[model samples]
Target: MSRDAASRPARERLLDAAGELFYESGIAATGVDAVLARARVSPATLYAHFSGKDGLVAANLERRFRQWRDVWDEVLDERTDPVDRLLSVFDAVVRYRAVEGNRRGCAFLAAAVELPPGHPGRQWLAADSRLLTERLHDLAEAAGAGDPTGIADGLLALYDGALARLARQAATPGLDTGDPLHRARRMAADWLAGRVPPGRPSG
Candidate 1:
């Protein structure tokens, strides 16, 4: 970091550095020294603000969750129709990914996959995703799906599948592909139209 960059508050600087490095390089690959170097903070400053590297990683994930929610909530708020709100959720990801240059895919998904099993950060990712699905369930119910939870499940699949493949789609041009989001939207519309079975539980 330059002298001017070093002048920022330590915590903010640490988060900013972690965000960039963790996204650019996987979290495991990024070490505390790299983040400290970018933030131009001493080890004591980092340890003071965060529990340690693990805490810093957790903080970065939480920061990303808030950023995503802010964008998604703003779009959802604009949309009053329950079905439109559900579709807006998917569109929010599309729009945000575009702003991200469609690189790096979903940060939460990335973090979850990259983190070792039994990691608290992995659970944090799951919890955040569950909250999103619950919101989807509310919309699916209001939109009159025979099985709102089932609809939420279907849409959640579409949401994650599209996100997981976007980078690949952009990379592989000869895959006879169409817009993933458009496909997901159409499939979601199928669920709403009762063309696609909701596959609700029988128990």
Candidate 2:
């Protein structure tokens, strides 16, 4: 931890340390001792703030979800057109990645994959997924889709695929991950314009 970081509250430092480590390294792969060392906090301090590693994991996931939500909401708020508002999610991602320094992909998706069904972190994961699904449904309805549920689901699938592609690109060397989010957004716009059907074959 830097001197500036060392000046922060123990909980804040711990969460920052845990968030970076858990996202950059898999949650299972990153141990609590690593987080403690990174934060420059003692085991007792971590326990005092988070109760344990599970609580810290849940806190970090919740923080990530809130960060994403705030970015998405800011982008959406800047648009007036319904379609523009819906598509602003891609714009939000551009800003989010820049601001968060997130190169791997979706943190919520990672947590969902890493944590088990009964894990505490699963609640935040479920909340993040639910927010995406419900918000997309609302946005699709606003955009005058014939079937909001179907449109929302299709868009959700596109978003998830984009995130997975990003992760794959980050993991592989010399991989040609050609603008997955942009491609997804274009497909969405085409579908909305009736230029293409959902699940159209890719050339």
Candidate 3:
């Protein structure tokens, strides 16, 4: 039987295995052999589903992007206020951090840095980041911001910085850094109130 025919669910199995391994262990550290072994599939099976390791990495990144979109959609769906919708993104991140086994940094971001510049996964990362920024811009416009693009970019920068800080602080055990989302929300409120610049303000 052909590899595809032999492994009826090869594609899904490969994706699931890759996601688990890639997220737990950095992409550079996880090799094709390790993925194949975890999935209990032969090299030919993997090749049949994905052209190569790059293809597999692309698929994994796409899967993660989809997952992130779904999570945002679920959280933002019930929010009618655009400003609340915009701030809710940070809320979701904070809630995610509170969850058990919640790693501080984003898996997609980690993978994107590890992958080569021309890699397919890099395209996915770029697209995903754009999607997020656009969504935030829409919210900012709805919230009556004079410059939605600028406001959205500022919010994105804050979100990224908070995530980075949270990850760095994760090294300490049982130490809660309070709620980064709350801090983000207060910061957004200040920006909206004209008390602070949308981006980092001068001291």
Candidate 4:
């Protein structure tokens, strides 16, 4: 480890190492030894801070959820149009991915695929899904959609589809496909406008 990395707290260093490695490679593919080697901390230190690899995985998911929420909150705060605010989740994803240098896809979704049925990491994935579904429902209602649940679920599907496309793009960089998030947002906007009434806040 470099002098700068060495100076940081063990927990932070461990998380930094684990987050990158788990996201870049499959979580199941990344071993605790790899995280320890990258963090330059003893196995005892890792246990003291996070119990084990499962705990560390949970911690990473929680941290990612917080970051995602903060980014989405910022996007909502910046926009006032009801339609724009409703569609801001996509915008938040765009900004978050760029800032975090994440090219694969949604971390929570990735974790969901890798973690076993009863793993604690699944809680954070559920929490992330709840936030998207509940917030989109609320925003859709505020945007004057006749069927808030339907609209919210529709957008949620689009969001998931975009993330899948993102993973494909990352896997094949030369595919020449455009931004999935942008395309998803545009589709949402167009669909929302049609769903919302004439006098209401249409896209």
Model-by-model lDDT, in order? 0.78, 0.83, 0.75, 0.90
Q: Tell me, what's the RMSD of every candidate?
A: 4.9, 5.0, 6.4, 1.9
Better of 1 and 2 by TM-score: 2
Per-residue lDDT of candidate 3, residues 1-203 (tens digit):
34654475878878878887887778999999999977778899898988899999999889877766767777787676556677878876655445425665777667767998799889889978888799888777766677889988888888877766666656567878776657867887666666223443111
Report the lDDT of model 3 for residue 96: 49
User: Which candidate number would show the highest lDDT if scored against the true structure?
Assistant: 4
For each candidate, what TM-score against the reference?
0.83, 0.92, 0.81, 0.95
Tens-place lDDT per residue, model 1, 13-121, is 9998998888878798999999999898899999999899888988888877777778888887777655677688788887776665545467787787788877667
In model 2, the Cα lDDT at residue 90 comes to: 77
TM-score, structure 4 vs. true: 0.95
Candidate 4 clash pair list = none
Candidate 2 deviant stretches above 4 angstroms: 195-203
C-alpha displacement of 150 in model 2, angstroms?
Answer: 0.7
What's model 3's overall lDDT? 0.75
Better of 3 and 4 by TM-score: 4
Q: Candidate order by lDDT, highest to lowest?
A: 4, 2, 1, 3
Name model 1 segments beyond 4 Å from true. 1-7, 98-102, 169-179, 195-203
> Candidate 3: misplaced stretches above 4 Å?
1-8, 94-101, 171-176, 194-203
Q: Kindly report which residue stretches of model 4 are placed more than 4 angstroms away from their true locations once superposed.
A: 198-203
**Model 1 worst lDDT run, 10 consecutive residues:** 194-203
